[model samples]
Target chain A: MLPVRAGIGLRHPHHREFLERQPPIGFVEVHSENFFGDGGRDLDVLGRVRADHAVSLHGVGLSLGRADGVDPAHLQRLARLVARIEPAVVSDHLCWGAIGDAHWNDLLPLPMTPAALDVVATAVSRVQDTLRRPILVENVSAYVQPDLADAMPEAEFVAQLVARTGCGLLLDLNNVYVNALNHGFDAQTAIDAMPAVAVRELHLAGHFVGPDCVIDHHGDRVCDAVWALHARFVAQHGARPTLIEWDTDLPTLDVLLEEAAHAQRILDRTRESVDA
Target chain B: MRDALAHWQRAFGAAIDGAATLPALRGDAATVARRFGVYRNNVRLARMAALRNAYPVIAALVGDAFFDGLARRFASTYASTAGDLNAYGAAFDAFLAAFEPAQALPYLPDVARLERAVHVAWSAADSAPFDVARLASLDAAAQAALRFTVRPGAHALVSRWPIAAIWNAHQPDAPHGFDFDAASPPYFALVRRDATRVRVDTLDAAAHALFVASAGGAPLADALDAVVAAAPHADAGVVLGTALRDGWFDDAPAG
Candidate 1:
């Protein structure tokens, strides 16, 4: 498969534009939960796009962090979708979104404990087994770091997940950037400690600067610092399939493509450097 | 480990309720509270945003402040049961019906019902229209005896207010000065996706009666008779023809 040069996180607002004029980009990704229904217009549109573009299924609602066994029904739905779409890459956040039956519908952090690690590892294995394919787990931006997680740093937690499940990592550089500022850690250090061999893909997105810290809102262009971090990531990991995600208050397709093109240029430069 | 998981779940729930912070398990109390606070905020924001997106008309009808408050209340009470937020607000219509603040807006429940229908129809399922050729191949007797099922994407909604008109008026291209009279008689609306577009049509009394009967498994002839009885001058041929053209039926004749 051609490497994921640069893709955009497809949103509903841009559906008409995408359908009308198939924009030039490396690939496109979508939130898996948005298409979880038995059948509907959403499925119809997705089917139309699947024929034209290399699509990726990036799930946001799997709640993989919940201690309860993964929801069998959700797994079955995702399995059916994967069978239907046969996306290039299937991914979900490395965060939990539910507790028992009550789903929070947000990516919640799991404490970095041996017990939590065991639970998360088991969940990933089960999901991979059911889907009959290896899945990539992406690190999410954190607003608060739990006390219990002190025993294990974020990088170690990610490395352990990759070790246990043999799943690839979608290192979201912007998330690391956001968390670094919010939690007062060095972003590059975190990236350096990650198991580079397992890093199969990278994510670049815009974030909002809040009063106390930055939030990974994915609503703007890639910041100077995040782009710098992306350059550093490519230096170590080579040119992986990098996705440019812009979720809230999305700009026109042209703007998003421009942002992606910038990433592509950086990737090309990094490839040259590595070749030398 | 299970005990810790349970405590975490409880603490998270309490945090949403503003009853307690995430308890310090292996770190400082302030850090735990702040970190856990992020999860709590995310849960509330995501669910609320989904509700707003699904019920934009409802949000517009009720001002932003009112809608946000209602959304918060619904989130705290229901707590999303499904991992998919697309299926999050299944109970919002009923909740709105009983909400004291919304009681004055009598048409609010119907609007909520319509919004839910749109959401369901949007994600219900992809289906090809019942093959016209198959229906034509059936003899007159077979056609009369045929029992058809609506595909998963099919939806039928009945409202006591002019909800269809109200819903259309809220669309992006709607004209100004569109007002609904609360005293208008109940309206029956049918929504189904031809493919990607949700087509909402208003059903006359006769067509509505026939559909409701057929949906309950009545035979075609009986349903026609019922339609004729309800509206003596109603054209059964026109109604059935429109339904067929709209791909409402999912099958032809059963052997």
Candidate 2:
């Protein structure tokens, strides 16, 4: 199990520093697809780092919400990696990325309807069975809101998925914040509807605010609102394994460690209050 | 509604592919188009980034605006068939070959091929190194019949253009005053992975033939004969010795 502390997403630029310094961060998360090669420097480096730190295999290519079903070849590669790494936690986003044989290579939002819910639940179950362990499903930031008249709330869809598949929740707070802002909803309400027991992890990342919408680019520092939301969730739901993700225009190791240090402070505060 | 979900995804995909302007999404038409534009842009940008990562030299050869347009056209024409982005750009080299705007720069296609080879060599599966002592242990006749295997992703490409020099010139910290003359002699590149880095070495005509023959599973004696035939004055011993020292060949496939 991952500790109730903070971690950082491992990017390519900081691999050497991570190997050499062996920072005191609680764990490190990596994009599962980046190391999916049969063998290479990325995989070799991941093996070396795994010996010292707790690692999380966070995936983006699973396409867990696709209507056509998950890709078997992708699942096979993921299974191979999991068998080798024995990661502390495995997780992927709740988004569809492909239709038929064409892959968009971007996380596309799914319509939050009953039919869509069934598709996602089945896919999640299949992935859990294949991995032989429960995996966490992260809520993605949606720019295109599903306009279906009978569309259920995003929280309801996720809650039902957890109940049906016995899967855990990787509650990405920044996604919640971004979606709330883009779609005009209450962030706290979204957080309140989450199945508390199923939440095994939390994600904090920065976003780019565009003309029509806010983009979850994972490129900047976490905003003040997201930080407050994270504190509230930790205080209410207690602490989970939280991660700071920065993907584009990556900064140095010191910056990521500093952000993680801030998260650790929030977790520590919440832990003390709960203990008292 | 099961059909509707799939239908919606299809329409949405069409919009992303630039086959249609916008899907029948909810909201005002202008607002919906504006929002949908974000997804369309994301799809194109992500695929373009993958191509850029694989062929940095190609991008460097053509400026950003031109490369962006070329990548956009290629992406729309060839849909990525795999979830792994690494597997997405294999056809870009071919796409560049038939591109009309890029005809003046004929070497671009070959350079793209070399870049793809470098990427494949970098990520291909690991293999055991060649066993020198075991070869000595074999009887002379047994050794002559032995067929060698190069490490996974190792490749030999002979091009009329100076593709290897162009690729090397674009690398960071590459020496200045590189002669970009298309009139220079053609180059043969032998791509191999050393430790973690992919090395692209220029080879002579005879050496290239030997590598191709050996990599094609030719018997040791037959491969050497081909090398000797290519250049009568070339010393077969020295050529094979250089290949061995460079960690080119993996252990011969089991019996």
Candidate 3:
């Protein structure tokens, strides 16, 4: 089981830092495809980190909502990695990134309709079958929300996904907040309708604040509003394995650890309430 | 419905692939265009950063602004078929080789190719080190017939320019040691993974010839013969000793 505590996203810049010091944190999460190569320094670094920390493999390029089935080669590479690491939690976005052979290399959101839901559910089942274990699918921050003719709400679509595939939800609260601002949805209400028990992990990340749009850039400190949303979700659904994700324009290791510590405090408070 | 999805996918691809025009999304065109611009920028910026990461020396050589422009152009022209961003720009070297604006810097393509090799060497599959003791045990005849397998992703690329010298000069951490030979000698870059880091070193002519031949699956005698054919002054024993000491080849049965 994934630990009900705080963790930080392990990125390339901090690999050397992690090698030199074991900071106070519950676990470390890494982008799964970074280690897709046969065997090399990144894999070696991951193995070393695994020895000391419970690792979560967060993937970005799975493209689970594609009309076609998931790519067999990408699935095989992911399976090999899961076998090698036996990570505490494995997760990918609930977004379609590629269309056939062209991979955008960015998580593109799915339409909140039955068709997209079926596509994602089928792909999630395929992934679970391949790994012989359930995986968490994260909600993505999207600029354009598809106004499909027969659209279900995002929460209902995700809940249906969980019900059909037996996979858990990686409720990215930051995405919820981002979407709320972008699409004029109530963030709390959307999250409140999710299958709470099926949420296996939570993601906290910083977003870029633009005048016209809020971008999920993961480059800055987590804003207060995202934290507030995360707090409400923890209060309602209980604590899961929460992660602090920082991608580009990375600060020093100490700054990342500082964010992780803030998350740790939240987890502790949430756990106390659950126990009480 | 599947075709509809594919159509939308293609439109989405067009929207993000450096096109200013909006695809026919299901929302208000004006609103959708403003919002969708975010995704377009995301795709362009993310892929640009990936290329920038993979080819830091090239980016440094061309300056940041020119590199960004080059990246945007590459992103527009090529579709990254692979899911991994690291694997996205396999065509970049070839793209640079024929790119019009970059024609001013003729050697940039080889430099791009070298950086890609170094990037590949960094994450290449690990192979067992060459066991030199096995070479001592073999009979002279069998030794000559012995084909060697080098560490994975280990090979030399022969270039018409002083590519190694140029690459070294561009590297932020590389020492200012290698002389930019005025003769503009063709360079052979030996790419190999040592411990946790990938090292791209300039090999002498004899060593380069041997690596080029052996990396292509030539036997020891054949590799030496190629070296002799290429340069009669090449010292076969010294180069062999150098390769062995560098853990270039794993002593395994030729399959």
Candidate 4:
């Protein structure tokens, strides 16, 4: 089982640190595509890191929310990696990234319509079948929720997905905060709509405050508002295995650990209250 | 894919691919339309970043602005079918070969091809070394008929320009006293990835002929004959010794 504590996303910069000295964190999550090579230097690096700590395979390329079927080859590759690594957690975002055969190679938004939900649910079910294990699907930050036909808000769509597909939710708090800010919705309300039991993990990442929208760049330090939201989130939803995701312009490993330490404080506080 | 999603993707793709207007989204039309630029810029940049990471030497050869422009153009022209972005730019060498903008740098395409091979070799499948003892135990006549397989991470490349020198010159620890512009004989590149580091060696004509032939599953005697025929003055012993050190041969076929 994944520990109910905080960990940082593993990037190339801190690989030496992890290999030489294991960090005091629960587990390290990696973008699965980076080590997707059949057998190579990158996989070797992953192997070394996996030995010292628990590893989570977080996928960015699966396009689980696409309307079309999941690519069998992609599934095959992912299955091979999963079989080899045996990660504590396996996940992809709750977003569509492909249209026809062309993959934008980015986490893209799906309309909150019934049709979109059907497409996403079907895709998730297919992936679950392929892996023969339940996978966590995270919410994505969208600049523009496309104009489309009937349905509910994004939260409702995701909540229904957990029920329909039996996949756990990787509730990305930053995405919720960014989406609420971009589309003028209450972030707490969105979180409230989610089924708490289904939320097995939480992602806390920094965003770039762009001119028009807050871009989920995963660069820099997490903002105060998001941290506050996380504190509130843990108090209400109860703590899960939260991850501090810092991608671009990565700081020193110590800096990442400090961020992880911050989340750990929140987790401990939440756990203490439950015990009390 | 449904009709609505497909239609949105068409407009969204066009908008990101070009200066086309953003597709109408569910929210405030004007605000959301303006905000869509983030995704547009991101998709374009993300694709460019993947290519840049794969072809760093090419990017270094061309300045940042030049590389960025080239990458963007490549991203716009080619639709990435693979879910993995790392596999998206496989056709970049071919694309660069025909690219009119880079016509001035004729050697650039070949360099790109060499770089792509290096990138691929880094992740190629693992292969055990050839059992030299088994080969030595065999009769000379038996050895003559034995076919050899190249290591999975090995790729052979031939280019007119000193591609190896150029690639090495750009390395952080480029050796002292090596000249990139000096005229030299054509070189055959033996690119191989052994565990951590990937090396690209410029092989002599004889070694190239012998190894290339051997890598393609040529029998021992025939391969040596090809090397002697290609360059009669070539040292046969040196060629064989180099091949052994380079982990070139998987002599024993899989049982």
Candidate 5:
């Protein structure tokens, strides 16, 4: 098994470079939907990468928040991919991206009410049963609060979800940072309340600061505050697998590796402190 | 909660439409509205960007501003049905066909169709190329009776306008002095991956006819006859030879 060190989100731009020189990182992750096709350059490149490193399948779609039943076609495609890739970990966001037949194509937030919880938990449980594996569900960075949601805090909602479903948690420290800043909450408090045993992975990505909100854009380097939260997460969780995801305007491979190395050093230091 | 979900959905829709004030919800209404708005923006941006990426020629034909407007309108009207954004723009060609503003550009629909084909081909499933050597071992009669399937990722696109030529000229390294009118009449294009790069080839009349016939499961002899009939002046032997060499066929014709 690959250790709990920093990995980079493998985007198309960096595919060729990684092929030529397999960089030294903890592991690599790719958007599962990107490889949903049968045969193509995307699949070809991904196949090559799988041969060389431990890969994690991160899904952007799957719409776990929808009130309707899980999309059978989407689950079938994901199942076919899991059989083929045999990834170390598989994950999707806790937010919904589709409603009935209409897909919004974005990670839309869910109401934290009991009704919404039942809907999302049922969806996640169905997916886990189908895949016969405990998939990790990542907390999405939200921009707004719905009126019908239960007054419970986001951390309490997440904890409730972990208790209801056996699925592991993919604690996105960056999302915690973004939501904390946007909604005027403490990022550390959210992290501290996370059910530590349910957390199997961590994600640290950059966000785009908008006029009214800080968006989880994943298009730049991890911010200082997000890094600090990530370090704190490692201290709390004992070095779970962390991924540095940069989707748009991706920098050179060296720059991404440097970011990963920074995270790796933090994890190493934390591990040393624990041993001492 | 149900009402709240509906309200959030509507607010998200309104926000994307550039509405100023969203309806108040139950929780932190302001925060909910803001988050919903952020999602709306991301949805619009991502879907429009996918359309632009898949249909670059359409974006080029209609300037960036016009394309952006069209993308936004299309996204709001045509609800995406699949989890994958790549699967979002299937109706774009038909949408373009009926779009009032684009009606003047009669060729735009066909161009959009070709672009969709290229996008689909780029993401289609992988399959092994047909084995020519294995086919050579079959008896002549069996060969004539064979039914061959095109590779899963291979797509045949036929358009009345010179759309493939338009697509080819937009390649990253295309020559600056290329002329669209210099290209011949309506042509058939075979879009498929050659190793890693997506390669587009303008198929002759006979090859196109053969591909269409074989795609419909016609036997080799019947398909060859249709090809010869479609382009009486073209050489069927050379067309088949080229197609076989290009990894277009998926298997030996079924006897």
Candidate 6:
């Protein structure tokens, strides 16, 4: 299991340095789809890195909220990978990306209606059953808000998913912050709605404020507001396995390490408070 | 997949694909379109990036603008069947073959094929070296009828254009004025991952035929016949020896 400390998302650029240095972090998270290949350099790197450090298989595919259902082929590949790696944690976004024949390969937002809730819960339960372990479902950053008239609040949708499926929540504070600004909701209240103990992991990433909406690009440093939100969450719910996720315009390993160190410091402070 | 939620997902997918105008999702039409554009942009950019990653040589040959346009067309023409983005552009070479604008560069399709092969080899499965000892232990008759399994990441590509030379020309350390004759002999390339890197080794027709036969599950004797048929004057024994030395076949028990 992942330690309740901080880790960095391991991207391609840092594979060599990450393996060589074996940085003193809690664990390293990788996109599960990236290593789904039968074999190759990425799998080799993952195997080597996993030998020493804890690993988290954060997936972008699986389309866990697909109305039709989760793709059995995709689920099988994920199961094969999970069996091989036995990662500290496995998670995918609570968004749909495919319908019928096509997969958009992006975390498209799902409506928060009861039917959509049933779709997500069924899919999540199927995935957990296949993997023989519960998986965490993360709240995706949304650009287009669903029809609020027919939909429940995003927090309630997520809470019901957890209560129904017995899965964990990967509380992405960055997504929470972005969605709050875009949809005109209070981020703190959204956090408050979650079952606190069900938050198995926390995600901290940077987003771009687009002209129309706040985009979850994950291309910059964690913003001050999100950091404050994270601190508040930790102060209230105690520490979780937090990750520093940077996907585009990736900086050197040092930048990610520094960010991870910052997160570790927050986690450490929470421990100190608990001790006192 | 026609439940109410599925209907909504399909409509949302259509809007993202530019198939249908902004569905009356939530909010006013203008406001909805503006917000929905974000998903469209993200999908296009992410899929385009996958194609760019798979076919860097093609991107370099065609400038970024042209390549981006081609990628957009290809993304629309072919549905992405795989959840993994890396597997998105397998049909790009086929698409480029009939692409109107790219027809000017007749060799572009072949180059795309070479790039796809390289991209695949970069992460293809690793296998143990061919077991020479096991092969030797077989009696003469058994050895003659042995059918070998091709190793993962080992592919033999024969193109009329000098695809290997074209790909090498675009490499980071390639010569400044590298050129190749379009009329040159067909290029037979063996693309394989050797522990550290995927290398493109140029081969004679006889050797190429041998590799192709092995990939097709032809017995050793029939593969040797294929080698002789491809190049009447070439030595089949020498070609087979080269294939063995290169570890083209997997060490798994032969069929």
Where does candidate 1 clash, by residue pair?
A39-B124, A39-B125, A39-B126, A40-B125, A40-B126, A144-B35, A147-B27
For model 6 chain B, the run of ten residues with the poorest summed lDDT: B20-29
Q: Return the candidate ranking by DockQ, descending.
A: 2, 4, 3, 6, 1, 5
Residues A69-187 of candidate 4 have per-residue lDDT tens digits of 57888888999999988889899987777866777888888777787788788888988898899999998999887877675877788888888999998989999999899888988
| Quality of model 5 by C-alpha lDDT | 0.81
DockQ of 5: 0.56
Give the runs in model 5 whose Cα sits over 4 Å from its true position.
Answer: A149-151, B1-35, B60-66, B100-105, B179-184, B252-255
lDDT tens string, model 2, A235-260? 98899999999998899999999999
Best candidate, lDDT: 6
- Clash pairs detected, candidate 3: none
Worst 10 residues of 6 chain A by lDDT: A143-152
Model 3 docking grade: medium
lDDT of each: 0.80, 0.87, 0.84, 0.83, 0.81, 0.88
State the DockQ of every prediction. 0.59, 0.67, 0.65, 0.65, 0.56, 0.63
lDDT of 4 by residue, B1-255 (tens): 376766776677667666557765776767776787787778888889889988988888888888888898998888788888888788888888888888888788888989889888888876677877777888878978878888777888888888887788777788754665446657678888776778888888888898888877788888888889888998786787778777776544832
Write the number of the candidate with greater DockQ, choosing between 1 and 4: 4
Worst 10 residues of 2 chain B by lDDT: B176-185
Candidate 6 stretches with Cα past 4 Å from truth are: B173-182
Q: Give the per-residue lDDT digits (tens) of candidate 5, residues A1-276.
A: 345778989988898899999888889999999899877788888888998788999999998877775798999999888888888888998887776666777887777777777877898898888888888899998777555535466667778888898788888999988988977888898789888878888888889998877888888899899888888877876898888888877899888898899889989989999999
Candidate 2, residues B1-255, lDDT tens digits: the string is 667788877777888888656655666777777888888888887888889889899999999989999998987788888898988889887899899999989889899999999988877887766877777889989888888888887898878887777878888978964765566556788888866777888888778888998888799999899999987899998998888878888864644
Candidate 3 lDDT over residue span A9-71, tens digit each: 999989998889888689999999999988889999999999989999989888898877689
Residue pairs with backbone overlap in model 6 = none
